[model samples]
Target: MKKLLLLLFSFALFGLWSERNVQSVHASTIASERLYRLYNPNSGEHFYTKARLEKQQLVALGWQDEGTGWYAPVTGEAVYRLYNPNAGDHHYTLSAGEKEALVAKGWRYEGVGWYSAPSNADYAKPLYRAYNPNALAGSHNYTLNKAEQTYLTSLGWQDEAIAWYGVNLPSPLIVDLSEWQSPSKIDYDTLANQIDGAIVRVYTGYRADNNYQRHLTELQKRGVPVAVYAYVAPSDTLAEINAQATQFYHLASSFQPKFYWLDVEDEYLSGGLTDGTSIRDAMESYRLTLATNGASKIGAYIANNRFATFNLDTTKFQAIWVPTYGDNSGYYENNAPDSTENFALHQYTSTARLKGYDGSLDLNRLSGQVSFAQLFS
Candidate 1:
């Protein structure tokens, strides 16, 4: 009897172990499936279900798996550093007075700089490290425009372009418009001759721009390549996002401009939502919906202040347009932060005056490989 009892106990233990092994395998499979990001372009929703049946169901309903939606988080707390061979390395404390004092002390103000680092387990991919020439002991420096670089070079400081980040030295001149500016007197040929391309606001929320079609017609008439943008105001729910995407697609598809941009700003997504990650997810859904339907050439137009405040991941968009009014004048000016990529298009001034128009216009500068002619083709 004792021998029989021992044999039964051993069997019971083996059964428990086998069950635990099966559960572990099951859990791992679920985790892997959850990591595979999926989006429904038609519905403007994101899904992370691990069930094979659920995935099949979504696929039948026009869901697209966008792979992983994970990205390396970039912290914006790095300081723009300055170095002096004589006085040593100094970091700017976000104080104009402190920077001026450093300049007075003959310290060379290096552009936005960061410590060079290799890919870690957390990042997996190579994280974007700021380019620092000196590799001196201090925090990274900020970015400098052509004007700022020229000024630093004049002061006998070495100027080397960013190692990884490449931007066109001088940005191509361009302009953006909406219904607010009356360009009735404006000649399309003259405007095209003056600028490389044009970006216009096609829709603001659910309301289509009053003059989007007219503006596109005029631009096309003059052989000018044009891009269009729709202002996004995502609600707390996925259904609301789908509605916005549907409205925007119907209006923007008619023109078929070179690029389609989602303009996220001014309490649009932030009005009702407080979670930055949720807002990011909502915008991603909006972009995905546009891409799946027809607008594949998508980009983002976000101001510097809002971009940082919202902690947006610009990498998701094929291109980025940033507006920064440093000088706040008619002339184009740029003071973009070095921490982020120097956008594809920079709206340097919103109050620029041109010969063909009476009121002020938003002026932009195209950098890198942003081609005006290619966009039309």
Candidate 2:
């Protein structure tokens, strides 16, 4: 009788261990599933998916991979996916009532997108929602970040409350910076942690920006990556271009910029010289001068609408930087430059307001898979 009793006790312990192990395995599986996020610049739309293939397809179709938006579970409440045929945008929700409501308003229910976590689940996190009242397409926005939701509302976006529950939500990578965000204007200690890289203005076409050296020394002291750019006047004589580029290299070389960008704007043709030939000549002069003066990585900062009109060679430069602010709302709406120029970096917004900084900043992000090392190297 004793022997039988001991065997049964051992079996009960083994059963308990197996049950806990299975539960842990399920939890791991749920946590491993990530909801990939992407942005459509042309359409101002954001997309999320649990399918790697779909994410890859959209990325291949020119979408910006915004990385994982949140984490889903192996099984829970079904999140329905809907498509507005007329607007050409996608929407997802966890409520059957909300799904039907949009469907009734001409949104075709594609099917269940991904599973949401159970209410008040320990691993679950809230996904905040927002709506752009001014937009007819790509109106709704969802994020797992409360700060981002708050920022959007400050920019005229309406808060729509928590859309669903997820296990993980990541901070968006907004690494690029510029001269406008200076030590006097913003906290350097905070800026150091926030900046991935910065491009300070050397010359603004007619004269040098006074903060160029100060910004450089500050960034260098903090071990922050730095670059230099000079705004070139379109009607600038070959002599002026040569002198400015040379002066820029000589003074700024000690700080060791990763790239020397020539800012060529069509709007700043000195003396109203709109000749495309003169513009191209001025651009080329600055580029060639920089190259001759030992600047290894020369980049061109061109306005999106000036690609054809300015007649830029583009092949002469190592990298292309284009500015195209979709709404100029001071936030990146993933608006790609409307140009044929094959660009390496994008200056998305000139009015970005970063934490610790009170003034507007020109923010940039790399195009496609381009990296800091590749641009500099």
Candidate 3:
């Protein structure tokens, strides 16, 4: 009788242990089935997941769970997003005046707002057409939005009420090089692999960039796309403007660069040329001289804030490149220009650190309708 009782007690304890172990396993499975929200505070990005195990997996790969949260769909309001085919940038605005102003300046409405709720994706309807007679074989210059027959009567391009063939978004990487970046120090192989193209400094006033030819040769050897820019100083006379343009033309014409840009910063405007009218007239002379010398696709490189100080006539150049370093270093949204259409190229960051390079470099993005291929083609 005693042996039987002891055996019963041992079996009961074992059963209890087994039940507890089973309950613990069930609890873990339930926890694994819960939902989570992972957030990256640094980049202000958020992600959602239903599996706790999946969340844990992402956490292991450098994500943090902000906590339990539900996903809310954003209901998009109908607003216009204007696109400039010449400059690869878009402007989102609700004002009719703003929209009309952009249309006059050659921006095409893509037809829908960006904030449409996920369930009902809004598609842009083609109402008008934009054409660029000067555009190359495969260029965005040939396309525009909406019916602009009346508007077309005043402009240079033909308004064909046809949809664009296709959108070929260009690779956005572009690097600017000057005498400061030596040819011997540049890792052309790495640079070519990393970037879509390069804009090399040809001359500043009458002095040529010492590394200009060597850099051009390296890029050409690597099959990298190339462009050229010349730094300019404020001049009161057409003679001085012609001298700078002549110097720029001689070096620039040899390469037949994809594009030519004039570097005009606040320093040039500050040297006793505060009168906006004078500044506009001075730039016109330079532009005309370059055109006469056979420099194709001319552009201007200036700071956004300085645009008003100089009262520049931006339409004079084929394109504009603006430098707006968010901080003193120059690459952040805080420093972006007030008007996106003012610039075709935005040199947002000047302190970009590339691998195998000793110093910081200027980084730029295409804001205009033109692309790397379009500019080259």
Candidate 2 ranges beyond 4 A from true positions: 1-182, 234-236, 266-277
291-317 per-residue lDDT for model 1 (tens digits) = 887887888888767876666677888
Ranking by TM-score: 2, 3, 1
Using lDDT as the measure, which candidate wins?
2
Pick out the ten consecutive residues of candidate 2 with the lowest summed lDDT: 23-32
Estimate the lDDT of model 1: 0.56
Candidate 3 Cα outliers beyond 4 Å, as residue runs: 1-171, 270-277, 328-335
- Candidate 2 vs candidate 3, TM-score winner: 2
**RMSD versus native structure for model 3:** 25.7
**TM-score for every candidate vs. truth?**
0.52, 0.54, 0.52
Clashes of 2: 0
lDDT of 3 at 294: 93
Highest-scoring model, TM-score: 2
Candidate 2, residues 21-117, lDDT tens digits: the string is 7543212223224577899999999998877678879999999999768756647789899999999999888889988999999999999897887
Taking the tens digit of each residue's C-alpha lDDT, what string does model 3 give over 241-294?
A: 778888898887887787888887746555433443376777777888998989
TM match of model 2 to true structure: 0.54
lDDT of 1 at 2: 8
